[model samples]
Target: MVSGQLFNHKLLDVVFENANYGTIIIDNNGKIQYISNKYCEFLEVDREDLIGGYIVDFIENTRLHLVVQTGKSEMGDLQFLRGSFVITNRIPIFDDKEIIGAIGTIIFRDLDDWKKMNSHIKDLLARNNLYTPEVDQANGARYSLHDLIGNSHEMNELKERVKRVAGGDISVLIRGESGTGKEIIAQSIHQLSTRSTKPFVSVNCGSIPEHLIESELFGYEEGAFTGAKKGGKVGKFRSADGGTIFLDEIGDMPLHMQVKLLRVLQEREYEPVGSLQPKKVNVRVIAATNRPLEKMIENREFREDLYYRINAIQLVSPPLRERTEDIPLLIQHFFEKAKARIGKRVNSIHNDVYELFKKYSWPGNIRELENVMDAGVHLSNEEFLDIDALPEYIKRDSENIRRDSEKIQKKTLKELVEETEKEEIERTLKNCKFDKNKAAEALGISNSTIYEKIKKYGITE
Candidate 1:
């Protein structure tokens, strides 16, 4: 019976000794008062070596001191030891609302524990093959749907259409001007779709040389060409398997490549260059072009069959000039980003500078706007971006518009343009602003167009 009692006592002691947590106690004077056996083992020291020693003498980082000083609980995941990592929490031990000392618990975490978390993510993207964080991070250059930045009715409808189209696996053809975020819209569609977790591979069809275009889309086998990779190389289509492959400037793809691409679209399969075995990939092709494909088809530069296949879903991103209302938001977002990046504190954008922006036709669209702002931020020494700091295009355009607005005011030219529009719109709204049928008749435009511009231009009584 006495032996049984002793055994139970020893087992209880062992249970306490081998507990998973390492506990440490420190005094207000930054000296360690007590450390549990687990901590002594963790620090690779004896009880005598740690007790009554300054905490800093053991732990090299001073963040712990700051936590004790502020009497706040601090927690973090860190590599607390060589080849060992831990998640630690340090809490202040208070006596009657006064922080007397601190007690900390360090819980070692195995690296393999997080592997399970990303395992599920990996399973989802296995078919497409995984892209590294470096690829995703490299592409995240403030280019997304957020850059659209408009609350107009037309914009809202367009967004709704995009949302509906993105949910499916249909091929999308986005049409817009050079800088008008057609590629951005394509990316948005990819991000919003079920394939968002997979690779969003992009290829500028126009930029590839004629000789290399075939090998680029359908990667070459080893010794297929003099400079091919040692093993077999994966094509963009295969790389974007089970995901989205954005073909930017698709109108520029050569006729021969277009015919080859059309076959892949028709059959949903492709063979790598110099490889006999065909690789079948389930990729949603999102093609974008500024060129009019129908006109190109007439010119025989683009294939009609390819056009029909890619145009299953169509989106047109209006130029920035058409959506001038969003210019303010775009300006603010870009300025804030620029300020944070360049370490500046600009108070505000100048009224004249804004006027210049509004007057200038952004031929390059949103990209040009950003470039202009970037230049303005770089050159400005004052709180606001002044007119003199603006590019010559903006300055010249604004001056011409101001001169024209002044010269044409209250004249026949104004009557034929501004007055004509305002008078027609006002007359339409006069007969019950809520009456869509009457408004369409009075305005001599479609009911949809009136409704769109009404919300667009903020035309409210």
Candidate 2:
């Protein structure tokens, strides 16, 4: 006989009957003992029709048979008969230690709903030009803050700083080596900020002609200059009025343009090159540069005042050589991305290929790394990548460095004495990570010797 609290038990059944998921219970004879109203609605059947039907008769997939036979719960994918909608979940109920009955539920996922959510997210990322064919491309070139992978303390600190600074309205100056993904970081900040819903305009300051820079930045009126369009083109600043404007290679910007740029930054308004009217725009500016602006200012190349204006919040990005540990993660990420795009079955990379990568100094940083990996994926004949598929430049440079070491090993007395002086300097540079001042102290050699050898070795850093 059933136990006490029959009324309370009925109230619980009423609550389960109203659930969104399709829930069912079957008896020892494989007949439906109890099925929720939601389950019948999913099956598009009346309650009376489903009450005595076999549970297996309705379940589309035979994979559910294991759960019924073994008295153990199991989950798998399934599709409904009417809508053909894809659903996934488990058989939930059991009668005893022996196989007797089961209950199952479904989770319906619509592709249209997923597409809508994905499109909305892409708009939030402020993706302008789609770089779909690039090695790092994922899901049609939508990048999130999480995609910026690096465990280096410097990278982590930079990410934390981006999160904090994204809320404020201050101008940011990102200083880093070229090909180090400065533009990516700029977009990430814009996407994470309150202005995510707004536009994000990226302009390569050095790419545009000096004469056209003014008009490109501030919109000109119709017929402002000779051969001007009938309808004035909107400037990047105006296009990014409520969002952000990324100025790349700002150090190469002409001095006259710098003066005008500084004025606009101070006043938040600018007259278009061809227009008499001044347009006001509320835009957050983020500038990036590979050159040393501080040295430029001292040499009277970059304006000191303009540097101070943009440098309100400075972010220094470390080069790839400084973060050698992140190479493996970058390789794996690019491999998966390439496989998805090219439909290749590449599953692994040679261990020696990674060792070679870590040994060489990447002058072009992450961008170069992506290019190298992409080329390897396309050119590789084997299922996994090997060193033979790498570019000639990388192979030649590494070969030259290794050959130089071998030459030092084989030398006569006079040659050994001559090389000993040079060897001492090279050893110090390696220990100091090529920092001249530290190398001088460690070698007990003069700073001038360190500088002289640096020129001889062709070390730029």
lDDT per residue for candidate 2 within 205-286, as digits (tens), equals 9999988998899878898989888898889898888888889999989999899889889999888877776778898899
Model 1 misplacement above 4 A? 1-143, 410-461
Weakest ten-residue segment in model 1 by summed lDDT: 109-118
Give the residue spans of candidate 2 off by over 4 A: 1-142, 401-461
- lDDT by residue (1-461, candidate 1, tens digit) is 01234224245346545655666767777787667776666566897787778988886553555566899888763422421234577888676787777877666322233222223232234224442223344333223444456776656677666666765678999988898778767776665555665778899998889999988898989988788889968888888887789999999999989988997888998888989888788888999999989999999989999999999989988888888877887888777878788887778888877767776789898889888888778777757878877778777888889898887774886456755676667666877555866888766789898888677556777
- RMSD over all Cα atoms, model 1: 14.6
RMSD after CA superposition, every candidate? 14.6, 14.0
Could you tell me how far off, in angstroms, the CA of residue 68 lies in candidate 1 after the best superposition?
Answer: 38
Query: What are the lDDT figures for the candidates, one per model?
Result: 0.72, 0.72
